[model samples]
Target: MLPPIYTWLKASNAVKAIIGNTPRAYRPGDAPQDVTQPYVTWALVAGVPDNQLSSTPPSDRYTVQVDCWHTTDKGVEDLAKAVRNAIEPNAHLTAIPVNNRDPETKLYRIALQFDVLQTR
Candidate 1:
């Protein structure tokens, strides 16, 4: 099954308000070069099937990384909060792997990781 990060985030009206319409949320390498800030990008970083002793695995666990970016620190933080509120109920937030400003671009980024269990 397809990792549900994209679908779940896009389905949130709160996320849409922050990032605008379709295409604001993107997979790595898919966002346009001139894409606006205060957007989000996500990727499935790892996965493993839930092994069972006697039957086929019933679910799979995935770790997804979500990054929120904006030119201003407050803007990026707001976007990150919106993202967490949108998805935290369905998935466990494993960690905040990155919270920094890119030196070259001067963009604020907050990267969050979530552990999601999906039924196979």
Candidate 2:
């Protein structure tokens, strides 16, 4: 099943303003190398099916890591805020956001973890 994160971000005008409309968000390794700055990438880091007494689980919970990247620190911070504003209404923030600059690429990145529950 597709995660709702992509759908939410793509639908948000704030996020589209920074990342563009065509490619709003990408899977961990799916973004093209030549992708422009102020882009977003996400991955499902973990999942757990709900347990029940007698029937199959009717829902699942997922932990996803979403990362915003840009050449400028302020740009990445703005992108990350947009992403959070889009997803935070439905998903719960699971970890404190972490940011760092890649020494080799000099790209600034901010990573956020969220927990999303989806019905099966």
Candidate 3:
């Protein structure tokens, strides 16, 4: 079974509007060099399957982390709020957003996570 986060983000009008000309948000390891300035990146931090019955396919619960980054805090905050609003609309996800500046790059970012459960 496939997780819905990828499809959801790809189809989200809110996210699309906020990202502007940026490319599709990508997983951490796959981000390209041009993935910069007012962009988003995310990864499924961890996942586990549950509720197996007599060797049946197990349900899945995943922790996904999303990062919104920009040279200034304005864009980061806007993008973060957009992402939160978009994800929160889905009743299944519980979203927590936190903000901090990256010490090295000096970029402002909002880091958030979604707790997702998938049962098949």
lDDT of 2 by residue, 5-113 (tens): 8889988999999999864588977888888777888999899999999999989989999998888989998998999999999899888567999898899999999
- Measured against the true structure, the TM-scores of the candidates, in listed sequence, are 0.93, 0.93, 0.79
Candidate 2 TM-score, true structure as reference: 0.93
| Model 3 Cα lDDT, one tens digit per residue, 1-120 | 545655666567777887763445777777677665667788787888885668865578888888888788888888877777766655244555658899987889888888777787
Give every collision pair in model 2.
none
Superior candidate under lDDT, 1 versus 2:
1
- Model 3 misses residue 36 by how many Å? 3.6
Q: Give Cα-based local distance difference scores for all models.
A: 0.88, 0.87, 0.72
lDDT of 3: 0.72
Candidate 2 residue runs with Cα over 4 Å from true position: none
| lDDT, candidate 1, 1-120, per-residue tens | 747777777888888888986738888898889888778989999999999999999999999999999999999998999899889988999999999999988999999999999898
Candidate 3, backbone clash total? 0
